[model samples]
Structures are given as C-alpha cells and as structure tokens.
Target: MLDTQGRNEPDTLNSDTPEQDLPALDIPKHERRVQTVIQDLPVETLCGRISRGALILQPEFQRNFVWNSTKASRLIESLLLNIPIPVVYVAEAAGGKQDVVDGQQRLTSISAFVAGTFPGPSGQKRDFKLSGLQVLNELNGKRFSDLDSATQNLILEATLRVIVIKAESHPDVKFEVFERLNLGAEKLNDQELRNCVYRGRYNTLLAQISQYKPFLDIQGLSAPHNRMADRQLILRFFALQRLTHLHYRGNMKQVMNRELEDHRDPSDAALKHLEELFTRSIDMAWAVFGPRAFRRYQPGTATQPDGMWEERLNFALWDTLLYTFSFYQKSDIIPNADRIYEEFLDVMTYDATFAEYVTSTGDKADRVRYRADTWRRRMDAVVGPPRSDSRTFSRKLKKALFEADSSCAICSQQIQTLDDAEVDHIVHYWRGGQTIPENARLTHRYCNRARGGRED
Candidate 1:
C-alpha cells in the first residue's frame, strides 16, 4: 500500500531461498562509520540548553515553527500522562552544539511552554496556555505556571529519548539518517532535506538567487516563503544545467542530491558568475514574457483572448526556458525575444510531441533532455545557433562594455553606455561568420543597423 508521500511500503518477505543461496551484500568498511547513541534527558535539561542556544531547535535546515497551541497542548498532555513519545534525532556539531534534525515541533513546543509564550494567530508571541485537553480535562485552559508544583515537576522532569548522531559520523550518513527517520512522520520535502544535507556556498547561492525580484515575479510568488519551492526551482535550474546530457539514471531527487553534492563548496568567483547568469536570464525572461514568463499559453478560444495563458506556473516550461536562457548568450537572446516568446506559445499549443515531454512526468533524465533539447532547438531557430565558445564571447563582451568602455566598431564612435551599445558579429551571420568574441565587436545599435546585413 502507498504511504502518505505516495511511496510504497515494503511487503513482508516470503522468500524461499536459503541464506547460503542469497547473494552477498557488501559495503566498504570505511563508509560504515555511522555512530549513534541513545540517551534519555530530562525535559528541563533540553529546555535549558535550547534557551542557552547550546541546543539548536531551529536550524536553517528546519521548517518554520508551525505547531498551534492546541497541538502543543496535546503534546504536553501526552507528556504529563507519561505516554511513550517517539525518539528525536539530533546531530552533534563541533564544540558540543547540537542541531535537532527531527522532532522540531515537539521540541519547539516544549521550549515555548518553558519560556511562557506561544505564537498566536497574527504570529505575535503570547502567553502559553494549554487548551483542548480531552483526557486531562481538568488541566484545560491552564498555563504551566497555573499547574500545581507536582504537575509542573512531572513535566519538567519528564525524560525524552534522543538519538544523537555523533560529530564523527559521515555527513552523508547523517543525512540518510535524517531522511529515513522523518520519511513518515513530520516528513520534510525534498528541498528542505537538501537544504539540510547540502549546507555550503552553492546552497546559500541558490537560496539567495531564488529571492531575486525577477524570479519571484515570474513565479508569481511574493516572497520566498512557500516551503522553499522557489529555492527548489532555482536548484533545478542548476542541477539540470549540469545534467543536460541526461547522464543521470535515477529519479529527480537523486539528480538534485548529486548536483548539490558536486557543487557544495563552489568558489566565490564561480558563485558570483552563477548569480549573474541566473539574474541576467531571469531579467531577460521578464523583459520578453512579463508575468507570463513561465505560464503555459493556450491559443485563443471562443470565450478567451487570442493568447489565453494559465495563471498557474508550469514547472516543465520553467525548466525548459531556464535551461535555454542559462545556456545561451543574452545578446543573442535579446534580438529574437518576441519570436522566441511567440514560438514557445505555438509549441505549447500545437506540438503534441512536445506536449508529452512537459505534460507527463518529466522527471526522467531522457524526458528532461528531450524537453530541454526540443525547446532549445525552437529557440535556436529564432536566435541563431549557440556557439561552442559563446561563454568566452559573453565574458569578452562584458569586459569590453563594462571594463574597457569600448566604442562602436562599425561607426568607430565611442559607445557611451550599455543601453546605447549592442554586441554584433564583425562578419555578419549570413556571410559565414562565427559568433565568437574574436569575430565580435561592441557597436552602437544605430551603427549596427547602418551596416544593414552587409557582408563587408
């Protein structure tokens, strides 16, 4: 039977093969150093550590505190009744600090009660009061302070079982533990788990770029507050960029995890380049398609306009467009923006073959490559083919325009500003010219127009 997350639960093993007939399952000794210790600590001790910041209840990896006062009260009631609670998983960081990987809601509720505050409807901190207690009806609507000393001591002295994954354990092992433990109850989304597993420069960069205004505007998101969905989209762009050739053979989650692991500690220069690349691509998309950047466009209907676009964001379209813009030059992209936008709409409307790539489950590596390649080819038909050395030309153009203040090659006049300049092929495209920096020059738009597709 499928679980809540749609994953199938394992069936009972009814194998007839003897143990000697089974194949050996081997794991490298060096990779098996996962050390975990179980301890039962008093609730007062855990709360004191949280208050002192020694126990990190809320790490960047954890979701926001979402437990309501009623739920908190239920947990408190359970504790007071001496019921067996689930063991919480914690990872030991350096210098004796502990990060609570699982059981955040339970721990946070405990901490909040100890601190005498609970978040109200408006998210303001208010006095913590237990309510909606069915078994413990007498204790309903009572705050911790209102409890008798014996009852308070019962809560404070309650021991919670914690599974501590030691600092010396492999990081991947810890991530696996976190993932397996939380897969059923209070499960984290894939990106949330990724944020915890891949905590480094690249992860930080993805979080930063996901909040860029153009990205937020295109996704119709006001803020990066939706379960890290925007951040996940940003991560998809980078991951698919790396796996564009469809080399990966696993699921989408595996692809994302591998990509994050590969880029966990990217250099500052690389991070800055990625930031610029994503920002420029997003800006270009905004300039071309406006609010309909990633939305699917339906052709005119009897009741709808000539181009009826869906308000909901389409991830398939987003990934295809992001891959296209991310891998192509902005100068090349800007010239055919209108055509690209129109053709994308037409492709979505008329091309049934392309539709399957996006409409169905497109997480397969081949599907990803197919959709990206199909859209890329369509865009190329409008923008001209991307050169193998296009990145070199892009860097050169930036240096020429921004660093050197280069002038127009056609008119031999100073190109005063970026808005006034355009990077052009010194040898026109129709005349067998390559789109390389050596064959390119910064020219005023009017000057470039003055050339008028001339071979010379």
Candidate 2:
C-alpha cells in the first residue's frame, strides 16, 4: 500500500486487522505561484474567442458532451431568465489560448447554440433547436437563427463569469486546481484524470494501444468508446508491468498515477518498445486462450452444473498472465503454446488457494503479489514438471469418501479397500457434470460399471 513517503511497500494480509488503516497523506504547503484573474465576458465575446481558437472547449481531460438538447435548452432558459450560473474555469495556454478546465458542458452548449449546430457523437454535428424551456415558453422549438434580432442581441450581450489561471503557473498547481474544482462535480475516473494531468507522447501511446483491434477484441470492447473503462484497463496492465519490472510494492492507484506522471514525456524509442510489447503480448494471449483468454473458470460439481467459462475479462488474471507472458521470448512461447495452455488450465483448476486469492481479495497489494507470484511459478513449471500433477482428489471428495467408509455411492455397499474404490462422477460428464471434487463419490468398480454412463 502507499506509505507516508509516497512509495509502495509489500503489504501483509491479516484478517484480524481492518483494511481501513490507510497511510496518512502528507501534503506540504508551498508558496503561491499560480495567479488567477476573474472576469465577466459577454457571450458574444466568448463565442468569437472560441471560433478563433482562442478558447478550447474540449481538453483531453473533459468527458464527452453528454447534455441532450432539452438539457441544453434549460441552460439557455436560465440564461434568458437572468438566473446566475456557476463560474467556469480555464487554464491559460501559450499564444493567448485558454483550455476549458471546468464547465465544459455549459460552454459547449453555448458554443453549439451560437454556431447553430450541436456536436454529435463520432464527429457528426447536428442543428441545435431549443426545447423543454420553462419560463421562455414562446422561445421553445426555435433554432438560434430563427430568433428575432432583439432576442439574439439579448443572448449575445449576456455575460458569463470566468476564472482564468495564468500560463506562468506550475503544472502541478494547475492540476491541483482542476482536481479541487471537479472533485464534487461530474467525477472523472482516475484514468481520465491522468490523461488530463499527464498529456504527452506516453499518454498518446496508451490511447493508440487501447484502440488496437486485438487488444479491443480480447477486452470485448469497441473503439471510440466514451466511458474510458477500456483505457483504464490498458493503464492497469502497463502500471503493474512497470511495478513488477522495478520491484516496486505500493498502492495500485498511487503506482499508476506516479508511473503516468513519470512517463508523460517518453522518448520515441521507449514508446515504440511499449507498443511492440503490448501488441505482441495481446496477440500471444489470443492465440493461446482464444476468446476465453482472461476469463474465470470454475471446476464444476454435482450440486452445481459446471460453471461454463465466462467471456468477460478478469482484471486480476489479465494482469498476472499478461506480465508473465511478456517476459518470455517468442522462441520459448510458439513451440510450447499447447503446453502453456494446458498448464494454465491445470494451474487454475488445481491451485485452489491462488484462485481464491484472485477472486476474493479486491485490489489489495497482497492479492496482486499472490496472483503474480503464482502465475510466475506456474509458468516456470510448464517446461520442467510432468504435464499433469497426478489426478488428485479434492479435499471435499476425500472427506466424503472417508466418512462413507468406502461405500459405493451407486449401490450403497461397503468396498473392500481404497484400491478397489474408484471415484465416480455423480453426474456423468456427458450429462454436463463438472469434474470438481464435489461432484465425485466413492464407488466400487463393478457398481460404477453397472450404473453405466447415464446421468444421475
């Protein structure tokens, strides 16, 4: 977890200790270097600035324009009614350009209305029409161009209060201001925040990698998505890989943020290396696991039908397996592809403790360690150990057999000895029974045969 020094330390999972023991954040006070100027500019002036590229309505940090025409209309109605709106914040950029840090939705709405068009998804722009107005009922259903000269003049003359952060401010100070202003507003996920705070070649590379067809297919996602979930997963993979390479042990969130901040401005060679690594790793995963690459697989039993393998990607499994595979040479992987696939399933099915660690422990540091360490060990064993680890009975099945005194489950008769007793699937395999221990029962060889291969 993150420590007082902003570094990660290996975490111990103690059930007795509460997980709420978070390290205190140490924020130092610094001299004020950021200067801000507040001014009320006429809507016409703002629109002119936007048209001239002096105002940046969409920054890398801003989410998509989500307001429907009705919501946009409501803002216009409020403006017409002389109701006060919240102040918009902007960061001053070079060449007299201003990046909209907050109030993007409001500014975009105004800009679209003034331009006589609303921005649509995928770069399609549509005509803007006012609707759902309360006080300005007469103005409802009218386009900006349809308004009379006096009405247009009133709107153009309306002023909006804006606060602009000077260009001379430190980037960190600007990030701090942006974070504080939007903390309670429409919340941007951590990845979205990172994209804004760390905008450079490395961040651009992440976006490009996220759109790669193989990467999207493995993730079960499509390109040009808005929610940023896919980007976050990509970031997660890169962050964990970096941590593992550096042998760093800390909080996942802190590690991700720090890594992005450090690598914001990567060299061309570094970006190319990362791109190749990500592409090759994803391709290998798809080739080996097929569509079920990062899904959870549960061994089925009699009480429950074998839980079919899931199609959804499991983040825990993805991080561990991806990082492990990225370490191997192509020569090592291509020849042993089948062996690696079989070993992965065997590890997932036989290693109960590792499965539990991945499924149960949320994103705790210890859980991350458990998964990575277990996968590493399993990968190493693939080329060395015997293909199968012996057909071992599960603990549950063994306990049941011992309690039954070697009684045949089919006939309920006692068997002579362990050698004569065979473990049978209560629900036959052909009938969709899972090969889990819970589905197994002790039975004599003859009784098992007499029962045939019929479903129970």
Residue 22's lDDT in candidate 1: 30
lDDT of each: 0.72, 0.71
Report residue 252 deviation for candidate 1 (angstroms). 2.1
Question: What is the lDDT for 184 in model 1?
Answer: 78
The reply for model 2, stretches above 4 Å from the true place, is 1-40, 91-98, 126-132, 140-153, 163-187, 222-224, 300-308, 383-456
Work out the TM-score per prediction: 0.68, 0.67
Model 2, CA-based lDDT: 0.71
The residue-by-residue lDDT of candidate 1 on 152-254, one tens digit each, is: 9999999999998887775555556766776577566566777776666787787778789877777666666445666777777777777774564535555
Candidate 2, residue 19: CA error in Å?
10
For 1-456, candidate 2 gives per-residue lDDT tens digits of 112221212221111112463322223356345679999998999999999989988866567898999999889887888888899988776567888878889989988998999898878998899988888889888989999998888788889999988876655555557667766776554556656656567777877787888777775555634545566667777888877834645445556666776787788899888888888788768777877788878877689866568655676787788888777644345556788888877777889988886566346667678778777777787644322322335656665685767777778878876667777766655334456777788888788778775421
Best by lDDT: 1
